[model samples]
Target: MDTIASLFSFITTPVSWIIVQFHKLYGAIFGPDTGWAWGLSIVSLVVVIRICLIPLFVKQIKSMRNMQALQPKMKAIQERYKNDRQRQSEEMMKLYKDTGTNPLSSCLPILAQSPFFFALYHVLSKIASGDTIGVLNQELVNSAREAHIFGAPIAAKFMDSEEKVAALSASLTDVRVVTAIMIVLMSASQFYTQRQLMQKNVDLTVKTPYMQQQKMLMYIFPLIFAVTGINFPVGVLVYWLTTNVWTMGQQMYVINQNPTPGSKAQDNYLQRLLKSVSSHGEVRGRRRRSVVQAIVAKGADRNDNERKFFAGLAKAGFAAQADGTVIKSDTVTADAEAGSAARRQQPKRQSKAQRQSGGTHQTGEAKPSLEKQQDTPPKPAGKSSPATPRQAKSGQRKGSQRPKHPSSKK
Candidate 1:
């Protein structure tokens, strides 16, 4: 027993030293007589330890996610090798190894912190028994002896009592009450964290062994804490309670920001994001409609094509605006119109005679001929001439002669 105690004391020395240093620091700030300072020092120790274990926490999350992802394949393997336990175990281990994930990695953070918990537990236990152990000097020992949280000693246990009956009864009562409260709080925090993961963050569709294990642990951890809390020193209880709170908050943050896929929390987050985007789009659409209305009210005579385009935008939940146009641009439309106008302005092809005479007619502008107009002598009443001066100038002859008047018929 002595050898074991010595080994425990040696292992706990560093943890006790850190706690004492923090206690001193808090004592300086809040004054030496404040019991809450020492209590807070234990909490600070938990914070320091948990902070150092962040990498393990990350690994745990990654391993759990990998396990969740591999659930289907794992189920298939189990189904195929139901009669062959040895082969099934080998296959499962092979799968885990190939994926670079250890099924036990999820327990690493808690397992790593167990030694520190035991160290603090041993240090506080020695102080409660009035012995200065390990790195706890006489000053820290005196402070530990004096520290009381709500009249309950920091190193006190629920079953510990003084020699005198009156003192024993009061001390036991105080210790029991405080321990009960701390146990409930610590157990509740742990339970709540697990509940959140199962209810909000875990995929219900997956009935894998890992998820089942998590559910089982949910009940087991709280029961364990409730059962064991009475034996823990007040300072150790404080450390555990604070760590529980930290874990709950961390789980909440993960559930809110990066919830497990196909989970209730993920669905809720996606729904919220979609609603926000849709609301923003509606507001922008309204603004665009107002702008388009303003442009139309200003009597901008938009062409049929422009009107059709704006109507299409409206139909597609988009709106046109003077500043924020939502359709094919006015510049492009203007360029097309300008091209059509240029085509209309081009001159038409001239006739062969006009080309030979070098008398081209510009578009919508005709030039007069250089030849003078001549009147033929009035035809005799009985004349039947077949050619006219115009036809003669063109070197052409009429095929039929004009008929004589009826008076010349005889």
Candidate 2:
């Protein structure tokens, strides 16, 4: 731990300077030597660092989602080159390159924060050893050493000896209990954050190794924290716990607002959107409009949740347009009802009497006449009527032809 901290020694001065600045602000209200002053300083430092890492966090999210989407292609490449390790590596790189994905992007926030973490660790370690480092002069160091957070000195560790804890004006039992509770809280917070992410935000429809890896990390991360937490000072634990809570809250906001397309978060989001749009008869906000626009752009490719959303809109007599606006569509509903009514209507059946009479039923409706007299002039008394010239050329009669007796066929 010392070696690692030394590797980031250059950052210790800046980290200590920031903490001292925050301590000055908090110390005035909470007392310069109180736990709240020092503990909140650490927390403030974490907030400042995390806020600066927001861009990296966003890139991490994009990278993780992109990795999930590329799993099938990655799996295919692995299978095709199962026997060729070098070629498989090449193809994997090609896939990542073409997709503009960096597998390491997901680690950017952690990597970016590590220097500060180690620098803080080093500073606290020095305070524990009664040494002044960075901008923490002897007077500030002495005050920090005397700062007790919930009966435990800020620089005390769970593994600290009784003598060391006594020297810091705290009992061993008090220090151990405080540190234990903090460690447990930190680990639990970490676990819950990852679990929330896996359960609500991940796209479960795609079976991928990326999901498996995430699940593994869900368990692994908390365990790692719990194991390493014993070595962390009480102040470091506070820093980690505060950061974990911040991360959880940030993730919840993202999952609620702009979740993955096929995730449960999206389903819930769309349901809420459906209710809002149905109540107001329009999309309410620019963010919601963008969401609707994307879903509309998906068209037939939309998932079940999105399809249900569209159906709900239609049921409310609202139609979503390509530009993400909803409009009342009374004509669409009326046309649908009219078509259904037409399908349900059957033609009136003709009775045998009506068919035989070839005239109207008792109703007053008129039927067309099949013939007025025959177009021909009255034939001479004894002369047989010759076939019409048009009929002769056509080789058949036009209207109904009489059937000849079978035995008298020509």
Candidate 3:
């Protein structure tokens, strides 16, 4: 328990302290009596956290995109040494090294957030429940209990209370209701943020497996949030909703400014939104696939096959050499380096006859006796071959060149 408390202290020590300070400052500005002040503080905390996380979020997203981009290459590597497990493991790591994409990037931000969440839980539990939380002196605990956002007391919102739902009345189920609503908002924001990323914000160069993973997240997080939200205090839900909303707006800003090329956000999400609001309100597909398919169909009309293919490759850097060596490319192989390259320019296999013929024959040589034997007619049964006459006459030549077989040594 002491170890757990010490671990708890690490996250709560700074962030929760800052948050408690924010509540104080907000209450100071709004007057200490109003619950709206606490509301504003939660909102404020969300904004600050979002801003602080922006760089990390960018790093996470960039890592995911790179992972997506390298998927085909990874697959190609897998296929190449399918029969060789040890080599496959080696090559897979090499492929990851080459791409600088860690699959774990998709999870790092999540893991980093865990401590902050636990700390916030402890802090809010104390504030709402008046638990005194060991770290907070009695004065601080009393002040937190009195804290309000706007005119509503934070303690009244059920989020801060740290009590079970059964303790609250049917009349006060509103607290649970509010909690549920906030939970939905949290899940919904997470859902749409992910949806937009797949349907809009991704780099076109993103690989299929990565895209599939993103698609999986669209469903996964919502379910997770829905199940988990009921257990969290209402204050925590507010924080979650706040955090998610901040992400939503920040992501929208990024799509508008540095939108990924060949992504739906660049091509449609922003454009469609802008258009719907524009005098030229030309709304396109409600779904991203439709929008992309439409674009591909239209683009195909103007682009010749080779030009279009190269353009696609150029954008993806598929045909471009990353490692300073020129690629003789094949479309079938999944990896850029290891794919169907060998097949594309495979040297034709030599027949057994050609292999047996020691090296290529140069013109203008007299046939050797072995060559003559092959060509020679069979002598009548009683007679020795007259062609033996050549070897007999020039025994030294044949003997010096190749002895048919030496005696086997013991």
Question: Top TM-score: which candidate number?
Answer: 2
lDDT of each residue in 118-159, candidate 3, tens digit only = 676677665655666645666666665665332233444443
| Model 2: per-residue Cα lDDT over 1-410, one tens digit each | 88999999999999999999999999999999999999999999999999999999999999988986787798888788889999988898899899998877856877898899999999999999999999999999999999999999999999888999899999999998998999999999989988989899887655555677778878998998999999999999998899899999989999999887778998999999999998888999988998898899998988778999888888788899888889999976887778889988966888887887677855847676755544757768987655633243376756556667899958
Ranking by lDDT: 2, 1, 3
Question: Candidate 3: which stretches are off by over 4 Å?
Answer: 1-6, 78-91, 146-171, 203-207, 268-410
TM-score of each: 0.65, 0.83, 0.57
- List model 1 lDDT by residue over 248-320, tens digit each: 9989988886666556776665455334333454323464345345445545564333354444444344544
Give Cα distance to truth, residue 87, candidate 2, Å. 6.4
Candidate 2: the clashing residue pairs are none
Range of the 10 consecutive residues with the lowest summed lDDT in candidate 2: 384-393
When sorted by TM-score, best at the front, the candidate numbers are 2, 1, 3
Q: Candidate 3 vs. truth: CA RMSD?
A: 16.3
Please give the CA lDDT of all the candidate structures: 0.73, 0.88, 0.60
Residue ranges of candidate 2 with Cα displaced over 4 Å: 71-90, 335-410
lDDT of 2: 0.88
